[model samples]
Target: MNTPPHFGTDTPRDLVGIGIGPCNLSLAALAHPLAELDAVFYEQRPRFDWHPGLLIDGARIQVPFLADLVTLADPTSPWTFLNYLRTHHRLYPFYFAERFHMQRAEYDTYCRWVADQLPGLHFRHQVDAVRWNPEHDVFEVDHTQLDTHGEAEALGRTHTRNVVLGIGTEPYIPDALRPLVDAPGVPVVHAADYLTHRDTLLTAGHITVVGSGQSGAEVFLDLLRHRPTGHEQLHWIGRTDAFAPMEYSKLGLEHFTPDYTRYFHALPENTRDRLTTAQWQLHKGIDATTLAAIHDELYHRTLGGGWPDTVLTPGVRVRTAGRIATTKIELHLEHIQQNTRTRLTTDAVVLATGHRERSLDRILVGLDPYIRRDNSERPRVDEHFRLVLDPSVTATGCNIYLQNAERHTHGVGAPDLGLAAWRAATILNTLTGKETYPLPTRTAFTTFGLERPQPRVPAARQAAPTLTPLVDRR
Candidate 1:
């Protein structure tokens, strides 16, 4: 096997991707087929680990398996769920199961398997910054490769015709718990790191989980199931009255459909902002299965003549969390209904708080003057998901596209797994003219050692195929 030469300053690549999350994974799969385009994805992790911490046992994806990274975008694409089943020899079992959704673990496994088959993906390469080289009409990416101890060893730089920002989301921690992060033995952790401390949390006499989303509920249930009898208690704290279920109606689920995203982008700016604020519960909410599990556990404990040490502190907000000692942490809670404040101590704190989109400022610092922002302070992107840059910088027919960074403009579907393959194809079509090459239907088959075949114009659509051009601010 030939090891691809290391990318450096002198060797200019067609594209350099900053992150290899599912979002960019889809892009890499699509770009691999375009022999004319040389692209590579730089991932910080040694290997792929998507939502590893929240892979609770028996937890299935809330979305259907059909909405996988590639299926919805390209059904015939090899990256489809069907291909995953076929490659794993589980096609018969999956068909017999007659299930549309799958366990979160299984989905993650599928993603990892696909990732392993894709080349030009540099693992353990963490990008530190991306600056636009106005003179050269390219991006200068600075990154460092980490060793086993997570220490940077090889410092390197690469220049690319364009850059795709798919850095994904950052775990959000509440302001109240910010202080506890530095305290000794505080055990203050976000839900993104739940698996790291699952055993410790299970052994703790008292555990408090803050947040009411899917992660929060999952953590609460996992703790309840794993804790030794009469040894530990779990408390679920949230701002909402109860675990709000995700909206899965035909029309509601449309929020994740491409057409809806287009509709959302066409709406007035004020209308889009209003929709996002009003529909926060739709995507940020928990699944019904998790809610039911909590309810069932409580009911079962009640039937056993006593309440298992569990409490749901809904409609309450944490005002502050501080370390009272090496072994305990104090939580100051404000009850919304009663208008009362109460103090509680816990052995450990699990912040089920969610995440926010990664900011582009971290990478494209030099191009900050060109990037536009929406009313909500997110990057303003066009329908094709390119950042609206200032007219001063020559775009060199090179476009900086975003994968998971356009939720505000594109709706909830922007960051979803369903749009992954479609977004990649969109970018590919935009970079290379419609007449350049036809897009292939199957995205999973092996081509030139790459996982997917190149995009080829269909015989029928060749004459009037849509043309997507690179953004030329010049």
Candidate 2:
């Protein structure tokens, strides 16, 4: 096979993406048909895998199938999920089954198919650092190729007119539970790795599921089904007041639309921070289906006129955790509503505490001095998804776009699958200065705030489809 053109030679590439997750993969798929664009994506893993650890057997993606890599931005694109089904010759079966939300494992498989066919994706290449070259007026990306054991075997560089970071997120282990996870003999594990340790966890006399999100509910439900009904010694607890269902009402979902993303970005930094904390249920709550399934499972177990030996408590926080001898875990707890404290010892604990956005500082350290920051010290991201770099850096005429890394600026939709294609299109539009993919003029009916004067260019409507001059890569 012929190798893709190498960057850093005679002419710089248009864009060099660092991390080939769904976000950048979307960008690559969308950018593929654009004739004037030249791009490459690098990933550290040997192959594409999205949330491999958390693809529990029957867990369905919250978003519908239309939220694929290219459909939302350009439904006609050949890379749509529907096309995947058609290509795999399962379109008729999919139609008969009538499942709008596909299973998590299936989605992971679909993503792998997309990644395999997409061009210019280099896996096993770890991007070590990115630096700006004032002389060449481009960004220099340093990377190391890894072998099977993940050790560096070769070094290379890429100079590009722009770069995109789609490094994605990391499993968030709270400070209180870190000791328990790191402690040798304990069976405490995050929900991200639940399937990997399922057998060992199920054999335990007692299992405690922590956190109240979808993963926690799914894990608890799975355990409920596997254990004997009469002796199911399971405990599920979290800091939330109750096992709350996610906000799935038609109107409530508008918060994820591009119109709302624009409105949210316009708010003051402090206001955005406050709103994120207040609107936890919008994205962090359990799906109604999963919640219902849990309730149904519990109800079925109670048909014998006796309650299953399962304990469920909410509004409870794990203050500390330790090993009880070498076989069990002891979790120190506190009640949020009432001034009460308690402790529980279990054979195993499953933490579904969720994930957090990874920091880009370590890789972008060389460009730190040239990067701009918000009041909270986070790199300021503009409406177009480009990092708000310093004037000096901007003067070099280079762009640094972000994917799934702008939650503070883009709101809950930052990591949402539904908005992935649209965000990718938006970044491409800004990069090539053209409407590479035509987007919808308006996506939501609700107006965010009428009082505040709107900008001349409405966020709801993108600029017209006019060809803009592209920056010469030479």
Candidate 3:
């Protein structure tokens, strides 16, 4: 980096963001007009791209268009998605299209466009580590400059009063299928890279998809459309008991509201953990449109009479897997309900097993002693999104905020695009000790608990309990 003359250890920036994913990008865009707050964001990628490999044709984002980077928090901001359309001279086309939900590719392009104009966003600069200097009471962020090809060229550091971690998540490869996915020339892959390996997968004789989420459904539908009708040898299996549509009902979606998030955070830790596991369908379920497309494709093939030579099974677990020669994969699966075992062979496997949060332990290693953790040993994030740091660390007034890494503390909406701006605004409000974006006291019609501790929390939001307590202390 050129290290613009004004930015140095002696001159600390107000904030420094680690990764330029959509989360941090939103923060940067919102912070752009705030001349008082000096902030800079670093990214390893050469440019912004949201799930580039999963930008399959006809795939649409689950959230509405207004859930874009800046709109939800600051609709009038010039960086809104509407402005992206206007800038590209496609506003009329977009208006006529009436697409409430944006296409995945278009969303990626919109983010790229926004990233291009946002100043102080350093692309090709990989943030290596962050350490707090007690003497200076500022964070020292070390990063390496990368060339266009992503090769490291030089090292540099920046000093900041605060740091935001938005490194995002990583594609998860299941343990049973790890060997094949790691081996050279093996076709087993994760759905995150579906587009990158589309041609090879399309040519494969028998393909098996190992997830039932939205990505899995989209990949299966895409493959079905291109393959010959009757010869479509595909197997789609998942651990879910049944293929389920996302909970998109008006009231059901209240779970993603700020009110619900706060309520969820105050619950007992064990209860929160159980709810996360049981509420998989809330965020992990397939979108209704994608589910319909898959069914419509299958129904179209049925017009010719026999099944489309595809096996769609649920409630099955992949017990183990092995390879039969180099070109074939053998999956040992156990039917969870029936307690029966079976073996299936395939030419290629797409493990849309979903993603796991990228660890902050690597970069935050220097501050480990001062960082507090939850019962699970994961870093604890308070209601304000700041890490629950020890007094020693908090004494410096150098806060560490998190993005998309607080699902355990925040709920399913932690990673949802709709809540991105709200979270950014919340973090900014708390960071600056000012309401940059004043938020509603409550947002959801449904109150999560029977007990309302605050008078400001409306009574209409809470429902009257009709059943007696299961465990009677009386």
lDDT for each candidate structure: 0.79, 0.89, 0.89
Per-candidate clashes come to: 11, 0, 0
TM-score, one value per model: 0.87, 0.94, 0.93
Model 3, residue 98: distance off in Å is: 2.1
Per-residue lDDT tens digits for candidate 2, residues 99-183, read 9999988888888888898888988889999999887788999988888899998788888999999999989999999998887
Ranking 1 against 3 by TM-score, winner: 3
Could you tell me how far off, in angstroms, the CA of residue 461 lies in candidate 2 after the best superposition?
Answer: 38
For model 1, give the 10-residue run with minimal summed lDDT: 442-451
Locate the minimum summed-lDDT window of 10 residues in model 3: 1-10
Assess the local accuracy of residue 335 in candidate 3 as a C-alpha lDDT between 0 and 100.
Answer: 94
Q: Write the per-residue lDDT of candidate 1 for residues 1-474, one digit (tens) a residue.
A: 112337565757878888888888878776766788888788888888888988888888888898777665567667777899998799999999988889989989988887888888888888898777777777788888888788997888888877888999999987888888767685778999899878777667788999988888888888887875445477889988767887776656756665666667887788777887788777888887788887887677767576677788888899987887588999999988889999989888998889998767768777777777777766788888888776554347666789898877877777777667777777878777663324444443222123356799879877875789999899
lDDT of 3 by residue, 103-216 (tens): 999999999888888888888888889998888888899988898788988888899999999999999988887888878665888999989999999889999999988888
State candidate 3's TM-score. 0.93
All candidates: CA RMSD in angstroms?
Answer: 11.9, 10.2, 6.9
